[model samples]
Target: MSQRYHVVDRPDSRAPLDPRKLAQVLAQDGQLLLPMLDLIEHAEAAVDDLIDVMGRATIEAVLLMSAAGVAGPKQQGKRADRDVVYHGSQAGRVALKERQLRVTKPRLRKRAPQSGEPGEVEVPAYEAMRKDGRLADRMLEILIAGVSTRRYEHVLPEMAETVGVSKSEVSREAIEAGERLLKGLAERDLSGPDILAVWIDGIQLGPYHVICAVGVDADSHKHVLGLREGATENSAVATALLEDLVRRGLDPERRRLFIIDGAKALRAAIDRVFGADQPVQRCRNHKLRNVTGHLPKDQHEQAKATLRAAFKLDAKEGMAKLEQYASWLEHQWPDAAGSLREGLEEMFTINRLGLPSLLRRCLGTTNLIDNGHSAARDRMRRVRNWQSGSMALRWTAAAFDAASKGFRRIIGYEHIWMLKAALEEPAKDRSLVQQAVAG
Candidate 1:
């Protein structure tokens, strides 16, 4: 074996308990015996306590080594040059998820700083945990995951008891965290994202409805644009969201596509804010749902197939076929026919623009934003009652932030060029074409 390095079977340290002694004690007659569950619990507690003890010992060992100038043993001549001296130990506490250790924290005094050296001596471990905010962040993550504050005592027994975790404190922290997220969402600069399209939809929480906009950039990345609380998808609410986007750097002159559920107010808002000629695609899926919802169960599949097939054809033919279907259903199901006829032309905007099938499939509906809403609902599923719009907005902002983390590029991203070309067509050229068609 080399003198420089050696390995021992076990380090010279005192074991907390001897396994053989424990077994002998357990086997003794007329002794109070622990049930298996209690024994296992006690064993786990012992292990945790031992781990804390080991950590404290390691910290003390490092302090000692620093004081000696070398990691372990100092050479005879080199020991005299040591600059760090261990002062004394003071009571201190550090938190870990499993436990908080009451440590005899070692103090160190260092020689005066030489040129270019730091003057202060600091505890590396203590400073590290404090700087990282891991302890606070871990607690916040637990609460955000819908863990009850009372149960935190069980989850983080030592830290919770030591710091006195309270329900009010947890609620305050969560609200503060949520407000920070909401502020970031509202104030974040949208100029950099290169948004190519925006999808808007409403989600209901309790009796409140929040309209959310999710934007897709040229690179196919999605961003949670913003949100507004509204009772219905009305012009005022829709205009506010669009104007907010414009204020935050969305270019109304850029001719980006608006993928939305077919609401007259939303369409009117787009025409007023963006332009009358702006490219808009009403969600085909929403239209399908509305039409089929009004039809008899026996007629649903047939209507759905007819509508879906018609949507695949060229704009004029598709509209003609749908009109024929509506006429056929006019007598037995006038309401269903009317639902199908409403916004019928807007549903085939993608086809009219002659976008590629792949890109059409991605942008033809507001499903992308709807998917994000689904994720937001999953995050907020634990929330029972909403107190106000502000409260709902804060929670929704936090939920959106969480949901947006997993956004991948839109499907059929490669064919995005086809849609881009359609959008880039000149307004003057489109106007003249429409005029000629009308003539």
Candidate 2:
């Protein structure tokens, strides 16, 4: 073999490694060095490897900083000046975003001022990390996004020795988070927002039924106001929901256009809670469905078109056309005719107020709250069981919370001011009438 030349054998002119010099260099050019270091580390690494490396490095840096805060600067020799002493380090788990991380937590002790006895001191960062509120929130989001508790781990980033991702753990976190969200929604103060209209409807989840109230503010923003668990959407449940809203500062005396799916119980509840004078608009869609359900398949299109045409006319003309249709259906489809005649004038509430077609289309029915209910259903579709009323309520609240994130201003929002003006017109007329009588 030929003689080998080693570079290490040559005398090197570079100075010995100096901690002080290294610190100065890092302090002066740390920002510039990061890109170079990244290039060297990731130059040959795969994308996934690069991500893992960066994530672990970031986590390690955070843990190191936390350790330093607790233990202070390391001493080369014994120093009695420091009050806090490093006792040791132990394996600890912390929740970082949605993931639980295993870290070597530095333990510390402090000498009691009075007793001179060393007492264990908890690290603030560790204490904060130990609280997995964010993890619970993430669990709620993932569950609502249609991931089952059993398969939750598959959706998360792979890690070594990951903890707190079991099905039971996920369920526990989800329940806790769901309860918090439910409580938040139930206790939210409605007095602050300038709510212009209210839509009330019911949704059936398994054997349980819940009456939900959604409010629209003057700015056309929607708020999931309240819900009450019931066996059916009866007057009692609807009344309780409405009374709860009033108690939560919905202003019972304030005139608001009430939209409902032609549920007499809901209408009665509104009358009882906010007075019958509150303008009520029955959902045309619900009416059409009820009517068509009574008629034959062949007559469905004609009845629907006629009813829709009736809705576009002036209040007097619309009511006349609807009455004529009801008469035409009286002999064969009395139920369909009755459905058309029921709450007929309420269907024209927007038309009577002379609102623009935009506002008419938006406020004419319970479509706004119906859309929200659809969103809630979509989020909860993955859930197969409903154990209790409380559980149903919790899941509903969580689903609504997730769905509310994507809510946009109602279509024809620019003319929402007109609806507000129309809602107040009756009150204004009543006030004028009272003044005139007094005068």
Tell me, by lDDT, which candidate is best: 2
User: Which stretches of model 2 miss by more than 4 angstroms?
Assistant: 1-53, 74-88, 107-121, 426-439
Q: Compared with the true structure, what per-residue lDDT tens digits does model 2 show for residues 1-439?
A: 8998765553655755543344333434345434433442333322223226444334334334444556675565766466677776677776755567665656777744447654887765556556535778888888888788877777887765566577888889889998899888889999999899888877889988877788889999999898789732488888888999999999998988888888888888889999988888889898999999999999999998998998988888888989998999999989989888888878888786668988889888888877877877887887888888888888878877877788888889999998888677766685674355335
lDDT of 2 at 44: 31
Clashes in predicted model 2: 0
lDDT of 2 at 35: 47
Predictions in order: lDDT:
0.70, 0.76
In candidate 2, how many Å is residue 87 off?
5.4
lDDT of 1 by residue, 1-439 (tens): 6577675665635555543333333333212322321332233223233235333443333333333332223344443344654444465565544234554444655655588886446555443322333344445556555565666666654421244456676667667777777888888789997787889888888888888999888788899999888733678998998899899988888888889888788888999889987778889999989998988899989998998899888888888999999999999999999999998878887887777777889889989988877876776676777788887787778777777777899988887776677778787887776555335
Colliding pairs, model 2 = none
* TM-score for each of the candidates: 0.73, 0.80
RMSD of each: 11.8, 9.1
Off by over 4 Å in 1: 1-14, 17-128, 131-165, 432-439
